[model samples]
Target chain A: MTWVYAVTLLILLISLIVGVWRVIQGPRLADRLLAAQLFGTTGVAVLLLLAELQSLPAARDTALVLALLAMLAAVAFVSRVWKVRPDSEDRP
Target chain B: MNLLIDFTLLIGILAIALTCLISRSLFRSVVFFILLGLMLAIGWIRLGAPDIALAEAAIGAGITGVLLLDTLGHLKKTGNLENDEPAPGRKRLILAIVSSFTLVGLLLWAVFNQPTPAINIHLLVTEAMPESGVSHPITAVLLNFRSYDTLLEVGVLVLAVLVGLALQTDQQAQDSLPGLPNPLLHACLTLLIPAMLITSMYLLWAGADRPGGAFQAGAMLAAAFILLHISGIKLSSQVSHRMMQAGLLLGFGVFLAVATSSLIGGRPLLTYPEGGAGMLILLIELALTLSIGLILLSLFTIANSPPHHKDQGGDHGH
Candidate 1:
């Protein structure tokens, strides 16, 4: 079970790292936002895995928090897009 | 057997991640990212963290996807601004790959090499499990044993909302105006909303017996609200009254109230007095779920609000 959890965590970590690369290399803000969302998803996965590995009870709570935070971040990013340019084509 | 499942899920997650990063269309990337969230949720479940799985499904896949799509709409409006830039050349891509692998290698090493903490949390949980009315060690630890962390976690959420409010200037009311709320959409909401409510309630009430609690319930409620918002049921600022704010703070408020009363009853802060903890936790979860839903919906609605008041008078105000 621990081994399964460890491998899952490892895969998630890789996903996050790749997502981070996308964030840095993003030619546009929208791409970066997408990448950021991936990062948060991976973070939640990591927390869940940790909860299992350590037998910690807060893994779910932490994951929940991460989800909410990710939503907020995504919303904020979207709003910024709306704010910066009213049209769908403005580049920042 | 477990290892096989883990490897398969890992491959699936990797594929999703690759598509999310490499996809050219913004819409496609958004969809893939949501899929990635789903896969990650399954990974959590496979790892034996059902609570985390619930959270990841509701918050990670559901709400985050909505937010991303909304942002994508904005990006489309912005026109191909970023796409104008050249995609990374081969040399840069190769360098990025090398560096990312190195970072991963280092992280893996750290994970494997870190000396285990001296304290045996498992032993502590086992020893203290008898004292907790709750059977699930994680729930007991979260709410009964190390509830301080939980309290602070709630506090962090409140603080984030406050910061969001403060940062948001010229907030326009994103109230749902009379538009064709599609019958299908309404139908889905009717079914899903009630079901979600029941599940949220169950999560809170069952925290003592199973892998559910306030945080899970709260996120679930938030997911329902997200659905409503996307379907055009907006969260109006005019309705964010003192009661609404109180509801938002209900989790922290109820927990504090209970914890303080415990002192007078001769127990420490947050120490549930025997069987009472389960009920108290339920009450907290219920309140938290409602507030969390409202909070999340409000934040997203406000964020998606057009800058000018006239700009948001109706559906997709131009």
Candidate 2:
């Protein structure tokens, strides 16, 4: 059971690495923002794993906070950076 | 295997930090910086501090990310951000490299070579918990054992909001008109906002026994408010500037009232009577939660206001 949690955590960390790679190689701002969203999701998963592995339930709340606030960055992007490209909106 | 995970996290943190610094576009860098904050939050969790983790995720990443993105937008609007800042000359580059290396070396040495503490405050806190107001050592410490520190911390937040208000020239008084009418997004927020409210209240109450507290609850409330703002629900001048000012000072005022009231009973300032400490702490926390939320919401609202408002209108600053 412990190994299962560890392996799951390892996979999440790998996903986080891949996410960072995408952010760095981002050809568009949206791509970077999406990659960041991926990190938030992955980070939450990792926190859940850590909570299980360490037998600490308070960390669960951290996961909850992450799950909730992850979209904040996206909402911010849409609010301020939403360009008036009705035609190019489908590019993503 | 555990050490392997820890080491990998360290590497990830370093990689993300470097990317945030090296990225060409300011906006992309800010995005990466949020990722770095999440990684750092995870790091804090591994170190067995969920309180810090909660704070990092909520305030460090969530609120700060919004502020940074807003700043980037402002800079772009004013034609200040170049896609690429010019490369540093060799002389400056070499100087940067040397200074960074020296700083890194000094930090590494300091972290590994620090002497052991003469006393473990953790043990002392747990030992004193029975006498303090609460079962949770952190709550006890912050509100009972060292109430002054917490009081001053809340004061600092109030001061920050006051400074933000003073600097708020209202040049950008345009309340953000929603970019597009998305009923779907509105529906989602309608569901999410209630949940956020419940969670915030839960956090405010849970501080007595768990890792949640006024700061976390207040920040979550502020997030909900900001989200609502983005969805076109203005915090409007309907909240009247005077009423808003009172809300900004609500926590400090409550704290001062409670702390001074205790002094009349022949106790020192902020010293709760033997059995009433818990109840008083809860009362103070409830008020602090409100003030903190209002202060944060006001800061966000002020930042979004137009720079100049000769003819004040809806959503204009005081």
The clash count of every prediction, one per candidate, is 11, 11
Q: What is the DockQ of each candidate?
A: 0.07, 0.45
Candidate 2, lDDT over the whole model: 0.81
Worst 10 residues of 2 chain A by lDDT: A83-92
Model 1 stretches astray by more than 4 angstroms: A1-92, B1-4, B77-85, B88-99, B175-180, B235-240, B261-268, B307-318
Could you tell me the lDDT of residue B149 within candidate 2? Answer: 94
- For model 2 the TM-score comes to 0.90
Cα lDDT of model 1 by residue, B1-318, tens digit: 446556766886898789788877665576577767767876776676777777776767767776776665554443423544468899999999999999999999999999988999899899988777778888888878888888888778888877876766654544322222356656766776776667667667667777777777777777666655655565443465676677777767876787788899887777887767666766666666676777776566556444445535433443
TM-score of every candidate? 0.70, 0.90
State the lDDT of candidate 2 residue by residue for B19-97, as single tens digits. 7887778887898789888999999999998888888888888888877876675545444457877887999989998
lDDT of 1 at A48: 67
Estimate, for each residue in A27-91, the C-alpha lDDT of model 1 and write its tens digit. 77677777767767776777666677767665665565455545544544444333434322323
